[model samples]
Target chain A: MSEVPNLDIIIKGCSKNDRESQKQLYKLYYSYAMSICLRYSRNYDDAVEVLNDAFMKVFSNIDKYDTARPFKAWLRVILINASIDHYKKNLKHNKNQELSETQGMTSDFRPDNEIRYEDLMRLVQKLSPVYRAVFNLYVIDGYKHKEIAEMLNINVSTSKANLTKAKANLRKMLKVYEDAAI
Target chain B: MQPYKDDIDQLFQEGLSSGNIPFDESAWIKMEKRLDAADTIAFAYWKLIYPLAVILVIVLAIWLWPGTSDNAESAPPVVTENIETHNNTDANPSSANNESSTTPEIGAKEKESYKQAPEEEDNAETDTTTLTESLGPSKISAENTDEPDVVRATVSENEATENSPSFTGGGEEYQSRFGGDLKILEGLDWMALDGYRGGEVEMTEVPMDTTREEVIKKSKLLFGLTVSNDWSAVGVSEFTNSGPSIGAIVEYLVLKRISVLAGASIGSRKYSAVGEEYWRPRWMDRSPGNEINTIAANCRVVDIPVNIYYHFAPKGLNQFSIGSGISSYLMLREDYAYTYNFADPNLPDTWVWENRNKHYFGVYNLSVVYRRQLSDKLYLGVEPYFKIPLTEIGIGEVDLYSFGTTVSLKFKK
Candidate 1:
């Protein structure tokens, strides 16, 4: 009873679409949701867009939230789905560009030997959107290549290829940073 | 594979797992605005009932109007066959089962029981959420249990990220971390572990003035094709004056049970009446009368009907709707055949073309529609409609009443 004492009330309030409960839910999960979105999105703006969109879905469909499942786990899934939706919606304008052509990824950006969260985020975001999505889905989110392929509407082989490409790019970016630090 | 492949994966998973940005107040404000625009999902009955009220008013007015009473008599007879029956079944099987099994005792039993195959549990990814749970991850709602470090994800593919199917929800470590949902704000006080964190590294802040596409679609559109036999039943003190009409319709639902439809159909209102008192359009020359002269009209018209409808959509494949609105008919082709009453009906001199298709706004149209779902996007429907002319039409300028039942194929978009 000591654990999550008010969570049931909050969930019930959220299910009824109480605005204060919705705000409480959004505030409660903002960090957790934002963390997930940032890993999949390209930048701060895109991640924020994805975050709010996911929250909107959460509020609209709270009644569908099965009481048996862990709420964090459910929220994680929604955030990931919202990120994919954002990616697909902007796929035309944000098609996979080469690392050099990536607009805001600056080579001059430097970090210490022990790369902090910001530096590490830039290293991952430096990968193209497709590669980043594949990496996030497969490596971080524990989705299989087959599952990722189905979610992304790509061939299984294509999913494997994108994961490979994402790893190689991340390795290259980390190497450049390491060489500069040395 | 590169030596750092696994290292790369572990590095990102570990790094991105725990940290969060300061909650931006603007996000909640914007979300509140969106919620305001599209209210919480209670179907507004007023939208559906408004159409019915309007139709009732019009029906009463037509019933009382002495001048138009003669035309109202030609309305197509009502077919009172039951449109909605056997509604005990539901549209979705799972929902039907849920509704049937949701007695309070069964509901309590349901919380303790799951239909999950036991073999599936052996394949559960126990580590999927254990990593995050150890990190004091947020967003939890659960009952207290002695087990502090339970790994709860089940093996269902659709629920790959979901917790144990039997879990009441939340996690012990997760709850202790935030202390409750509201403790996340106070948790932010301890959130300054790294000053350079939370996407603050030279990130470009988008202007608050930047707008998104706010014109989200509030309604769904349906396209239709209609083919029917149209009747001009003013009787002319005679009977059986009907013609063929073919046209297309576009309808969109503005609310749950209310829709506005507008259509343009090319229909002909043809009949033979006594030539003695036949009224002529100004553009036509009065026919040179002969012995035993009578009139036959073969007029092609384009009818535009706009209607507001209220529908009773049951949880089955069939939907029934009632609508009342106005119709405007354009004179497409008018050829008055002047016969000596004994002359050949096809005699060349007996036919005269008076005017081109003239746009004439004429009648009040009412329709009773029945539609069946053929497939997800397509619907098979029959709509029987009647038009009481507000103004007279054609060479006779008679109280030309039109009635028809159209078979239509509707596709929803």
Candidate 2:
């Protein structure tokens, strides 16, 4: 039952719809959960929306939590699912550039490894909702493309295409940022 | 420090991994309101679940309780009575049942019955008196007297545990003097309906054995539909690919503690490869150039799985089992889309290999399955499994090892 520190009482309270305890629980993992939401969100406002939605789920389903597992893993899954839900509303624009067209674009695209974390997050935020979602799911969250496709209600090739384009766009943005840095 | 320019997955994985978001009090306030609203709605709706659950529990209890089979059972057999029975006139034994009177053997049996009648008369009278007491005056007259109204008291008219006993014991004849109306098994201990009079006895007990066997056999065989997601990792490739599989599964319990399971499903084995590790089939016109490319190989396959499971707990509401199996993957259709570096495309730009075979041998699999019996004939199950590939498959011809979980709803025969 290794939970986040001081979570036993707060989780119980949250399950009981205790306001103060819910607040404490939310604040406890606010930044941690928001970091994930941000990578998948378009901006700060969107990130907050996803974070709040994920928290709502956590509080609503608090009683179902198994204390034997790590709490973060459970919370992470909920956050990812919530992010996917938010992304689905934006999935109508599900178009991607042809894979062949993605060629010749990476020439001399030496990555600026010294790029700051905040800048990288901004660069990720610049991707379209579907691309950012696919990138976040496949790269950071380590979901397979098949899982991403199911979550996003799309095909496997679409997930792969989105991930490839996401990385390409990120590199292109990194290049512009690197030239600006010089 | 230099890095592989194309492989940026790790870069973002590391960059975005720093956890924690600044606490937003406004967001919490907004969520609190939503939670309060949700709580009210949930309370209003969830109250009905209690009553529903209670009703379901009552139904389940009655359904599963032992010996309370059906009203058709538990209900007493109907016997028609009140026909005036004729007086015992002709003691023609051959006209009564399946015996011939002219035969010396039957004559000897009748003489034996006449002898035993005097000795067993006291017990016979007492048992008959009980049947006579259940209704109007008895129709049977062992002393050959008046025609009594037919008594509706029927013995062995309902199903009993099947018992086949000797027709005669101690040389005492079971044949009644009047013959068929009161044919009795003199040595059968299952029932001693010593004084059933003027009632036609039907052999209803024999059918119960087949009925019981049918129920047992039906429960032993289970049929189910299954859906699963498996991730296959080709040899020496860091990438793990996933595909959805839908199938039908059949399980037959061969023993109390073991069962055999088999399934046939169509599944996709697709992956995103981003390195030089490429296995080309004979279909491609060109070979690999000196550049990293992306090959999104999409494959549809038929997987046949055969396995044996040993149950840890078989007869219960919940069952746990460990199983090991072999799966054969047959590639049906495969299409690979290759996007290579733009620079090096002059020298053939493609590669090919021969020895293309559609049939892939079995991949060994092991799984732990948990099933909860939802009803007498239905079960819900989840099985987590791992498959180690002994055969190379797909257009890439890679040893595609996979691990996944399958969810199933099974119905027992």
Candidate 3:
């Protein structure tokens, strides 16, 4: 219980940029916060970058420690926000490449058209960056479509539409695999 | 909502399949050092006060408990006095009558009555013996005037005969022992009988039914199987969709409702949901690393159940059990699949690749079981069992090795 109070004191000491205190704070949350960052990053090295960047923010804003909420929970929010910022920067850069719009067959889809589980996963992984992000946030992360639109700076309908396309593409790939296996 | 089912399920599972990324070894060591440097006074106080409080309470209780005993000392004297008075009164009744003239004390009414009964019996016995001797010559009545009515007649004749001394005093002076006059108390002899009495023991025997009519029972287990649209159970829903699974159970009939059964069960569950990704400038190789990619789902779980054809139901078989207990299946192991997808088939074999498997044992359950008899040898059962794995897998050190529920049918002979 008192670890929280001690953590506050430690943060205060780090804000002074005391070399030992700074090292102590860095070492305390580096591994765990980095793991969280890794879950949201492109690779291991990006996770470490996000971790270092989030900790610098934590040190600068040590005065905001409320002494009420858990230190870990607060640290998690900061790390998540940092990872999001990093993701958006990459998203903007990738959008520079012109994408050729492909037309769908525009037919009602049947779910029972047997599909192998493996091929479906490959097709999902093949989705464009924006669609995959929207699909993951909305479907896997349990975020509402509205939250997805707000987070990605896109309209709710766009998020919904992308998810539908992602599923459709996966189903088509799965159908081909299931047929070949038969 | 339409089950919210999507390809994202597949992606999540694929990501988990990538395998547990081991923690950086240096990170744990640094964490320990940081914690050690932090001082925690409140924790120290709590540790000190708890044991101190417990010791004080124990000391207070021992000091305050009652310490002395007065009743144990006063008992023996009362018993000694009662024995001495009881013996003297029985031995000298006439001497006691003369001593009363000297002491002028006849104590209690009951004690005086007890003394009078023994003296009266002695007097009566002497008179009867004299009458029998004198009456022997009474037939010569007229000649009996010499046998005066003031007759000490039989008494006087015996007195002359008793004046003759009998042979006395032979050998050694020995102290009397062995048959000494020790009085036995009431109820003292029952201790041996009490020692032999049996203590409480509950022995129950399940009797066999006279009628050999058979009764059948049944049971089942079911495991939900998940398949990533991506071919795994580890990552995002955008990546995985589970396949269909089906299960059922049955048992046979024996005496006293005991049944033996054999049944097989099968099912699958998907794990791994795809997650958001970021690029590390340091690790950027192919161009500026400017694209967002999904973390592929990694680990998934699938259950394949085995059938033990002659397994008897676990209950009621004990009613007429010839042996110790219920005989049932001893589960060997859950089947596992260590599957990997070549993210880049063209890459060399040694290229860094995402590793994951459906072989994780850490999901919700590991053991397969049958419920009680639904009919005869037929039983319905479910076990949400778990196994602590012997090896490590996935992003964590422990691989969730085997998991699933069983819906089975058991057949008996």
Best by DockQ: 2
What residue pairs clash in candidate 1, if any at all?
B152-B164, B235-B238, B331-B357, B332-B357
Residues B264-339 of candidate 1: C-alpha lDDT, one tens digit per residue: 8776777776645466322122223433355677788888888998876332456678999988878866756444
Residue B301, candidate 2: Cα error in Å is 25
**Candidate 1 chain B: 10-residue stretch with minimal lDDT:** B186-195
Scored on chain A only, each candidate's TM-score is: 0.90, 0.86, 0.62
Residues A44-68 of candidate 2: C-alpha lDDT, one tens digit per residue: 9888888889888788778866554
lDDT of 3: 0.35
**Tens digit per residue, CA lDDT, model 3, B171-216:** 0000011022221111100111111111111112212123211110
Q: Of the pair 2 and 3, which is ahead by TM-score?
A: 2
For model 2, what is the error of residue B268's alpha carbon versus the real structure, in angstroms, after optimal superposition? 28
Find the candidate with the highest TM-score and give its number.
2
Query: How many residue pairs clash in each candidate at the backbone level?
Result: 4, 9, 127
Model 1 lDDT, residue B328, Cα: 82
Q: Score the docking of each candidate (DockQ).
A: 0.14, 0.22, 0.06
Candidate order by lDDT, decreasing, is 2, 1, 3
Where model 3 places Cα greater than 4 Å from the true spot, the runs are: A2-9, A19-24, A97-128, A139-142, A165-182, B1-413
Badly placed stretches (over 4 Å) of model 1 are A1-3, A96-109, B1-6, B38-413
TM-score per prediction, in order, is 0.39, 0.40, 0.26
